[model samples]
Target chain A: MFNPPTELLPTATNQSGTRTAAVPSVGGRTGIARILLSRDTVMIYALVAFVIYAALFIPRFASPVSTGFLLLDVIPALLIALPMTLVIITGEIDLSVASIAGLTSALMGVLWGAGLDIGPVLIISLIAGVLAGAFNGLLVAVLGLPSLAVTIGTLALFRGLALVVIGDNAVANFPPALTSFFTSKIGGTGIPTVMIGVILVAIIFGVVLHLTPFGRGLFALGYSKEAAIFVGIKVVRAKFWLYVASGSVSALAGIYWTLRYSSARSDNASGLELTVIAAVLLGGVSIFGGKGAIPGAIAGVLLIGTINFTLRLGRISDVVLIIVTGTLLIASVVAPSIFEGVTKWLHARRHRRTLPQASASGATRATASGVQERK
Target chain B: MTLDTSPPATSETTTRRANGFAAVLRLREIPVTLALIALVTLTYMANPLFLSQQGVKDLLLNATIVIILSVGQAMVIVTRNVDLSIGSILGIVAFSTGTLFVTFPGIPIVLVFLAGMALGALLGSINGCLVTVAKVPSLVITLGTLYIYRGLNNAWAGGTQYFAGDRPDSFGALSVDTIAGFPVITLIAIVVVIIVAIFMASTRPGRDLYAIGSDPEAAKLFGIPVTRRVLLAFLSNGVLAGLAGVLYASRFNSVGATTGTGLEFDIIAAAVVGGVAIFGGSGTVIGAAIGALLLTTITSALTAIRVDKFWQQAIVGLLILAAIVIDRIARIRTAKKLRLSEARDV
Candidate 1:
């Protein structure tokens, strides 16, 4: 009784062969289609396409020298984006990352200027970042304050503290060995030596996000906090640790930024947060959370870095670069929703057309059943 | 009948509930107001010159643009949206105002103001369309426009900056001219705050914005035109930002590509500190105006007290954190009270 006869199923399908064919294979083939058309895949494709385009058309952009410069420029953003991808996936933001980096740089400068050993200065700067992140975690995760508001406050506070620490002084007397080491490339390859460290960070973040139970819990937490709690996910603890990670990673980026430039100033990596966020979002991470991958995010960072490098190599003004990044950020978000809306509308239209036939058959079946009951 | 006895109980609860709501409304603006007064008094005590006529004038002038911007921002925030592009809007418009004077030396000041506002409205509509039509979050869209508009300004104004000397004397006098010991520009900001406060408090569309912010899905289900109201909020915000830009041109030393860069954070901080919920649904233009006053005064106060001026930004940051934490605590207490009252009713 539960399974309809094969003959009856054909009657239902007789209204439209095309509809039958379209509807029956949704379970298997559509899954493959969806995977292929996913935002991450699209981002990877775009990244590859743009690189090829740049290498082909842009003069001097294909060279190893440009590759090294570009990689060096994007290292800070790339490093920060790793932990940022996790934070965003859990549906929070850390606008203070750049400020934390700035503060770290300022502290390093001050400590180094005070004749402290470089080793201790670096450790203290990183510790300061951890403390800053802990402060944010206390407010946001423990106290339940909104992350957006909390981070904006910290953004200002950290940057302000940076100003007080350095007082507009730029510390440039870093040991020459370390500065050159930051810019040094792998032998025979144009990629910065720092890329190795960046890639390692990326791989660690990827494994944590894609493989671990804690990461799976974050996806659930992003979708519904109450449900996550019901499932025993330690929401507060998870978020606190994410904030800590973001802070520590930002500090690492700050260190890299300072050494690469051989300068530590209050404004070091000041606006880097926006660029990192833009890249992450462009990588197909849902701004609302619960979606994104490390590889996609890496592709996003490289894509923007390559575009900017190409533009600079072409002698285009920075204005165009800014505009392009903004446009791409908006387009990346808007395009997906628009596509979804269109698909939904199309599906609705198809359902509406098929509804009359469905109801007619339903009415006939109801009459037959009524006759049988009466008999 | 039970009805006879229930009437008195119901009436008593009704009056109590009404009082509770009124108290909450008063409480929202009280903390920011108290902070402002305390800061001013303490600063004045530290250095009498802090409240001298020139000092007072400087404070008012300093807050004028921020006050205007925050008042506008309150409208958008009230509807669960934000406009980060206002800084960029102000920058582009201020530069245009400068360019107008540079190109047409005798252009009427009123026309420039109108032009700036119109441009702001146009830019704002783009944000509104992207948000309302595209169904994207306002935060992301505005962030995009922030960069895009700033880039446009940079490309247009490339190394050319219009200074105070570039504008006509009368144009600059708008900021200089005073009435009743208040600079004309400051008066304009006051009028803007008052007008916006009234509109938000007593109008249907304004109240609808609050409803939308409180629960967007419910607001839509209730037949409120959420899209149109949100669009209107953005439109009005744009107009106010434009007005601030024209005033910014009159008051500041120079107008260029980066004229208003980084001002968005300050405007947002003022609104948040003023009691405007960053998440939306509650906050008043008046409170935000006071917040603007408080923040700008802190800068002057720190300088006057010979405290490191660097502390000003840190103080502003601390105030924002304090404001939001207070807001959270208040919300929790209110919810608890409401639940207890409901249990009693049952």
Candidate 2:
């Protein structure tokens, strides 16, 4: 049902802005259709379909209270994911996010338990997060150690620090005012301030990634460190800042988690780094780095949340949900390859049909004429 | 200029001697083995009972499962991939093997081992398909499967735990039995190490794995069948992890949902500490196995000395840092030498 003229595809020299004028008519053009089947587009459609389905079936799914709850739940992860998306974009990972958050949470708990106020605790936590990130950044960007190895080592380092600071105990019973502000509804809208904070952070990330030169540099660095350095992109500094950003965002998540739970524990968010990463992958961010968007990641978070909530509501066993999630993950990755194969097969078939038998006649006629001349 | 008084033969000899020294240093385990010996000696001074027959047995027995898993994990990590689902796989197979033993009272214990391995292989192949055929990063694919497998185990077990009384004497004996004054399980781990070492050093496909992990895109360009080899790596890891699970079950004589929870990190830690680069392309199976043994031994010795559990985490963190520092120095020296060689070649 879809085909395109061979000439419509751009050649090597078509670098000018006027190339759009050469676009073929839309009817039966497989090129545009293939573009629609791109991974990002597929994820976007899947997310939209899920949201619509949720809104239709679940009575309270669209209500202010539930929406507020969902947004609040996703805020910390979204904030952490913002910087992680950038870090991964630049071809690195921070496995220490959860541990860093745990450390921050413990720091907050210990300070508050010792009779400090919320403001100072928050400041200290943020600073700690930034410093932790700087440590990782320095190790990777300056020392040139592999990010994975460095991060894994820091995972234990940060977690151990949290343990030493907190010393095997849970802290709860925060001042009512602090906890209230964290969980409070904004008048009748039912959305908490924390959710607002997360949205603002996401917006900032989106603008930065889309409008800034640093964003483009990240993509360049991911594609090739040698090329980025050759082009004077300040690869090391860019990488260092990426880690710092990831650390800061993870701290923000930690603060929100502490506020929401009204407690700070050393083991808070244990094993959560995996989920944050899963959201990023599901959002269509290439794990290989250099491609992603905040909006796509937010959509991915929502999809996961919906799936989790819907499965619970449906009373399905956890095992079934796991199997389904596994299946979904596999399908998501598999679909692109399948689509590419089909497109290649169609292109080959089209080319074979388009070539004429008269080409054979021409060759024979030329041969016969040559023979006559020789005779 | 300072050495101008020295003869050219003296300088050449010095260069050769330096190269020889480096070859010895390249053995990788010298530092770690020394550290392990120091730790053991210190523990013995702190309490001679730590080296007693039972203490030694406890250390070896505890280290066996982790050693097995670490050898397998080294294989995957060397290929620049990870198997996060190994813990979950261990959990599922452990419980499944237990459940099978319970349901079929007449089934031979030997068959249980085969069945456990088969189940693990099946789960691992699923990961391979998702990672290779689907082209997903191993991290995400394995993370999904981690939860999926754990959830399956949880639901299947239904909060039920099989206790020591439920299993036959043969099952427990598999772990407890001694061969020439060493636990049979420890011997099994050693056997695993020897086999994997041979495979890694003597096989064509194994060398290809190193090439792929060093630079996957380059490997593809060199016609290495990148996806197929990666899938095989994951499969091997899965089977080994399953075998570890069986060993875990046999040793403890207990199986439950929580069994093997959070164990993947320990396996990873051993591999990393053994000089297996987390980003892949370098490491040794024997090094990884020794790393596991060292970690387990330290834990047992520390507990015997009545050290606080909190100290365990601190020590582990410090050890990891020390290992990374050592790794960094070695990598820099290697790079400098390689650059020097290239300059000379030019």
**Best of the candidates, lDDT:** 1
Alpha carbon lDDT of each predicted model: 0.85, 0.77
Best candidate (score: DockQ): 1
lDDT of 2: 0.77
Model 2 spans with C-alpha error above 4 angstroms: A1-42, A345-375, B1-22, B215-228, B304-306, B342-346
Taking the tens digit of each residue's C-alpha lDDT, what string does model 2 give over A257-367?
887898889888777787787777777776667667777777776677677666665666655656666656656655644654454455334534775442354432332
Per-residue lDDT of B1-346 in model 1, one digit per residue for the tens? 0112345456856875878977765467888999999999998998999999989999999999999999999999988888989999999999999999999989988899999999999998899888887878888888889889999999999989999999999989988889989999999999999888989977778878897888776676567777888999999999999999999999987999898888888899899999999888998999899999999999999999999987877888899999998888878987998899899999
Q: For each candidate, give the interface RMSD after superposing the true interface residues on Cα.
A: 10.3, 7.7
Model 1 chain A weakest 10-residue run by lDDT? A1-10
CAPRI quality level assigned to candidate 2 from its DockQ score = acceptable
TM-score of the A chain in model 1: 0.87
